[model samples]
Target: MTSTKTSLLGLTRAELESFAVALGEPSYRGRQLYLWIYGRRARSFEEMTDLPEPLRRRLDAAASLDRLSLVRDTTAPDGARKLLLEMSDGLRIESVYLPDSPGNTVCISSQVGCALGCAFCATGKMGFYRNLTAGEIVDQVIEVERLTGARLTNVVLMGMGEPLHNYDNVVKALHLLSDPKGIAISRSRITVSTVGITPMIERWCSDDPPAKLAISLHATTDERRASIMPVARAYPLDDLMKSLRRLAHVTRYHVTFEYIMIAGLNDRREDATNLKTLLRNIPVKVNLIRLHPTGSDLQPSSDNAIARFLDWLRQEGIRCTLRESRGVENSAACGMLFAQEPIRPSSTQRRTLDTDD
Candidate 1:
C-alpha cells in the first residue's frame, strides 16, 4: 500500500468483515477476502479474482498482503523442510514442514528470537530480538503450506520462541489461523508450546476454543528446571502445576508435557520417578524428546537412557512417546534453527525482501 497500510494477512475473520463493511462493501466480501488471503494463499490484492476490479484496485492502494518473504527453503532427506522467512525489518525467523505419516505438521515461531535463555536451545542463545506480530506468525503457516503444496494437519508454535512469552500476539495468531472462514484449520489440531508460563496457562483456560497446550517441561524439580530454564525461577513448577491442574479440569484436555532427554543431566532413573511424582495429579501426556545438540554442552540421552525413561513412564501409566528427530542434517531439528545468521550460519541462511521492494 502507498501509505504504510497494514497487512491483512493476520486479521481475524471478524476483523476482515468489519474492514469490508467500513469500506462500504457487503459483509460477504469479507469471507471472500479471507478465503483469498489464507484459503487460497493470495500474495497480492490483484490475486483476489472474485472481487470487482475497482474494489481490488482500491484495496491495492489502501491495504497490503505483507506475507513472509521466502529466503531459503531447505529440505532434508527425511522429507522435513525448513524455511527461512524474512520479516520486513530484515530480521528472520524459521518455520518447518514435517511430512509425518497420517498427518503433516508445520512448526512456526512466535518471536524473531527467543527471550527465554534456555541453556540448551540455540534460539535462546541468540538473545531476544522482537515479538513477531500476528501477521508474521500466521504467514509462517501459509507460506510453508504453499512451499510444500500440502495442507498442514497440525500446527505447533514450537520452532524458535516460547509462545507464552509473546502471549497476546501468539494467541491472536492462533485465532487468525483457526478461523474457519479463512485457513479453517481446526483448533484441536493446533498446539501452543511454552516454557511453562503459569499465569498465561491459567488465562488460556478461559478461551472459548483454545488450541491444545504443550509445556517444555525439561526438568522435574524446581531447582533443576531453573538451572536450565531460568523462567522456572520466576514461575516455579509447584506454582505452575496449580494452574495446570485447573486447566485440565476446565478444558478437559490432556496437556502435553514436552520433556527433552538430556544425557548425564536429566536422564537419571530418579528423574523419571520424580517427574512421575511431579505430574501425579495433572492430566497430561509426555513427549520425550532426545536433546538436539546445540551450542550448549548438553548432549542427547543415550538410547539406553531414553528407553529406560520411556519404559518407566509407560510402566507408571504415564502416556509417553519418543518424539522422532527430523531435519537433523539441515540443522532444523529441535533446539536448533535460530534467526541470527552469525550464531547459526548454516540453518540461518537468509536474505531480506522489504515489502516495499
Candidate 2:
C-alpha cells in the first residue's frame, strides 16, 4: 500500500539531512539515512540497523521509503525482462532490464505515459497521464536492481516517455542517480533519449549535462519526421540540427542519433543521402534501429534496405550501427512499452514526494 508520509527515496544527501534536522535529529542522521536508503537499499526503517529504535519509529512516522509495486514481470526469449510498476495513483509505467555480460542496463520511464504521439511508439498511443516525480523516476532504477538481483551498470531514459517534456523532474532524478553519496553511478554510464526538443537540448547543453544525449531522428526530412513524430512539428528539423551542432561543439561525448527503420516510410536511398548531409558536420554515431512492433500498421524495414542504409552511411565516412530488434517476442524492445492493464486508484488523494518539496 502507498504511504502518506513524505517519500525519502528521491531526496539528496543534503535534503535528507535537512529532513532529519526537521525531525529534531542530528544532521548526520540524514547521512545515515542516505546510506541506508540508497547504499543498503533498505525497504523499511526497521532494516536500518544503525539507527536507534526510537529514531527509526520517528522516521517511519514522518517519512516513507516507498517504492513502486511490481505489477507484472515479463521476460523475452532473448533474456530481456520488462517490469510494469504501479504508482501510488495506480498508474503504471514499464521499465526494461537488459542483462549483458560485464554489465546490465535498465531502460526507465520518466512519465506515466507519453504525449509525443510518435506513430511507431506504443506509449504515445496511451496519451499523457502525468509527469512522474523525481522519486518515481529514480525508484524505477532501484526497483529494477532489487527485482533482478543484478547491479545495473547503465541507465537509459528511453523506455516509455519523452523525458525532456518532464524537464525538472528528469534533471532532479539524474542528480540523485549520479550522486557519489548514494547510487554513485557515473554520469557517463547514463543516456537520455529525447525526440529532439530543441530548446531543452540547448538548455541541457548549456548546463553541462551529466548523461549522454541521444536524439531520435527517424526521418531525414522535417515533413516525413513530423508525419511520424508530432513533436517535430513544434521544433522543426533545422532548429533541432542547429542545437545538435551546438551540442557537438560543447560536449565531448558523441551525440547518437536513433533512426528507426520503418518498412517503406523512411528507409530509401534518398533518405540515407539526406541523413548523411544533415549530420555532415555533427559528431554523431547513428544507430539504425529496426522497428519494434507497437501493434501499429507500421512494419520493420527489410534486411536489404537496412544493409544498404548502413553501407551508404559507412561509405560517406559516417559512424553507423545496425541495431537489430531485441526482446520483440514479448514487446519489451524499443517503441513497445505500454502498460495495457493499469490498476485504478481509490478515492484517496495520491501523495507525491520530491527533494525540492
Candidate 3:
C-alpha cells in the first residue's frame, strides 16, 4: 500500500529541516534529505542509502517522494519531446523539451488549463482548470531530467497556462529551482514569459530574482491585441509597455518579445514599423515566430511576408531574429501543447500549412 503522508517534493530546505526535527532526527538530516531528493534525484526514502534504516523507514511511513506521474510522452522528428504530466489531484499539464547545442530547454506549464483564451492557442481553448502547486512545477524538471538522463540547462514557464496568473506558485517554483541544494539552475537561464500582466510584471521587476523575461506582444496596437489576447483588455498595451520599460531598468536583462505572425492580420510593413516604435525605448530582442497551424482560420504569415517584416525591423535598427519553427510534426511546437486532440484543420487550412517553409 502507498503511504498517505505529505509529499516531500513541496518542502523547502527549512521545511525539510522542520520535518526532520518532527521525525525525532537531527536538523542536518533534513539537509541530507534535501540533497538526496533533489541533488541525487532519489525517488524514495529507501533510495537514500546514507540514512539509517529505522529513520528511512520512519520517513517512508511519514513522508512521500511521490511527485508527478508521467502520462503520455511524444517526440517530434526534430528531437523535440513533449511530456503529459499528471498531478496528484489528477489535473494534467504539458511540458516540452527542445534541444539545442547549448543544452536541453524545458517548457513547463503552470496551470492545468488556460483562461487567457488567446484565439490561436490550443491550451487556452481547453479552458481554465486549476493552478499547479509549486511542487508540481518543480517536479516537471526533476521528472524530465530523470527521463532524459541529462541536466536541463534552460527552462521557460510558457507552456499550457498563463504563468503570471498563478503568481505565487510560479514564484515559489523559481526559488525552488534556484536552490543550490536542489536543481541549482541559474537565474539567468530561466525565462518566465507572460502575456503582459501589469501588476505581476511590476511585482516581478521589483521582487523576483533576475530571470529572463519575455512578453507575448503579438500585436503592436491595443485594439488588435485585445482581439486575440483577452488579457490586453485588462492590461492595455500602453500600460504593459510602461511596466516593461521599468522591468528593463530594474532587471537590466534584455527582455525578449515574442510575436507570432498571422497572414493578413498582423503581417504587414506597417505593423513592424509600429512594433519598432512601441519597443523603441525598451531594451528588447524581437523574436518573429511562425504561427503553428491549430485548426484555426488564422493563417501564418508567408515566408516572404516574415522576411519583409524582419527586413523592416532591421532597417529600423531594432534587434530581432526570425525564430526557426520546431516540433511541427508531433504537434509539440509553440501554442500546440494540448492534452486533447486538436480540431482537424479544414482543407483550406491544410493547403496554407503545406505552403509554409
Highest TM-score scorer: 2
Worst 10 residues of 2 by lDDT: 348-357
> Over the stretch 1-357, how does candidate 1's per-residue lDDT look in tens digits?
336775787887788889899889998898888888877889998888889999999898778888788888889999888888887777789888999744989989987777677888888766666778988998898888888889788998989887877778888888878877667788999998888877777788876445888889998888889899877888878888888888889988888999999887788878878888889788888999888878787777899999998998887789999988899888888888876453333334332211111
Candidate 1 local distance difference test against the native: 0.82
User: Considering lDDT, where higher is better, how would the candidates rank from best to worst?
Assistant: 2, 3, 1
Give the distance in Å from residue 331's predicted Cα in candidate 1 to where it truly belongs: 1.0
Q: What is the C-alpha RMSD of each candidate to the true structure, in Å?
A: 5.1, 4.0, 6.6
Local lDDT at 226 for model 3:
86
Q: What is the lDDT of residue 117 in candidate 1?
A: 79
lDDT of 2 by residue, 161-256 (tens): 888888888998898888877777899999999998888889998987578899999998888998888677788788888999999888888899
Whole-model lDDT, model 3 = 0.83
Candidate 1 residue 193 Cα shift, in angstroms, is 0.5
lDDT of 3 at 27: 92
* Candidate rank order under TM-score: 2, 3, 1
lDDT of each: 0.82, 0.86, 0.83
Q: Show how many residue pairs clash in every candidate, following the order shown.
A: 0, 0, 0
lDDT winner, 1 or 2? 2
